[model samples]
Target: MVDYKLELIILPVSDVAAAKAFYDKLDWRLDVDIQGEGGFRAVHYTPTGSHASIIISNGLTDAAPGSTRGTYLVVDDIEVARADIASRGIEITEVFHEAQGGIPSVNKEGRTPGLAPERASYFSFAIFSDPEGNEFILQEITTRLPGRV
Candidate 1:
């Protein structure tokens, strides 16, 4: 069987330079920035240790600016990751877990302050947003369950 690996995500941005500055502040590695003819531009960045990367570009997609939501980043330590991200001049939400052990919903109704009871893996979370309001969730998972990689 051929293996299909997820590689890059394209994010639509009204201003490429502003998006570049925002990701730069997070210290994500800057992979490339290109400006082509007819004002087309693309900037790529990858989070440290992540195989997948993202592109914030002009003339790449027709999606609205900041339309994406609920993108998640897995972490082994929620507090440490959240703290480090917050210390980088990012405004992040307090740590929260799904209520009654439910999955995190699109809205804020299911969230409860602080980590999950017993600090269970995959239950604790924190949230942050990019300059254009793209939401990202940092989920704490000390151990993976079953076949998750």
Candidate 2:
């Protein structure tokens, strides 16, 4: 065994302070705050009762601001999540579907399930970019039609 359950996810940001503020508005609690290395410090925070955590670190290399990657969040209520996030003064982009063809089934090669596209359905979601230009998506799986997986 690896002897480890999940650890942490570190994201590089141009401005640690601004990144911290953005996450703060999301109601995330800070776990670690270390800025003693002449602004080379990093901040750690976690979403309650989750094994995953986000760590915003000062650029240790050539990485620049808004260089972070995308993150997807599956929420119970997309609208509520959008409203709450927007109310925090965070900029939210438009919400739409990615045009998934349909739910995935057995793979062609039987190796793995590569892509399972989502089509039009009762529920909807949206996508938005963080201050650092990191794309994030909010999705809601509301209803499961009969005989549809």
TM-score of each: 0.94, 0.68
Off by over 4 Å in 2: 1-6, 60-62, 102-123, 142-149
Q: Given candidate 1, what's the lDDT at residue 60? A: 88
What would the per-residue lDDT of candidate 2 be over residues 21-81, giving only the tens digit for each residue?
A: 8888888778998876566878898864456787888745456656655465666666677
lDDT of model 2, residue 2? 65
Tell me how many clashing residue pairs each candidate has.
Answer: 0, 3
**Top-TM-score structure, candidate number:** 1
Q: Model 1 lDDT vs. the true structure?
A: 0.88
Clashes of 1: 0
What is candidate 1's TM-score against the reference? 0.94
Q: What are the per-residue Cα lDDT tens digits for candidate 1 across 1-149?
A: 99899898888887889888989998999999999998788999999879999898878888898877877888989999999999999999999998978567877888899999999999999989888877888999998999988
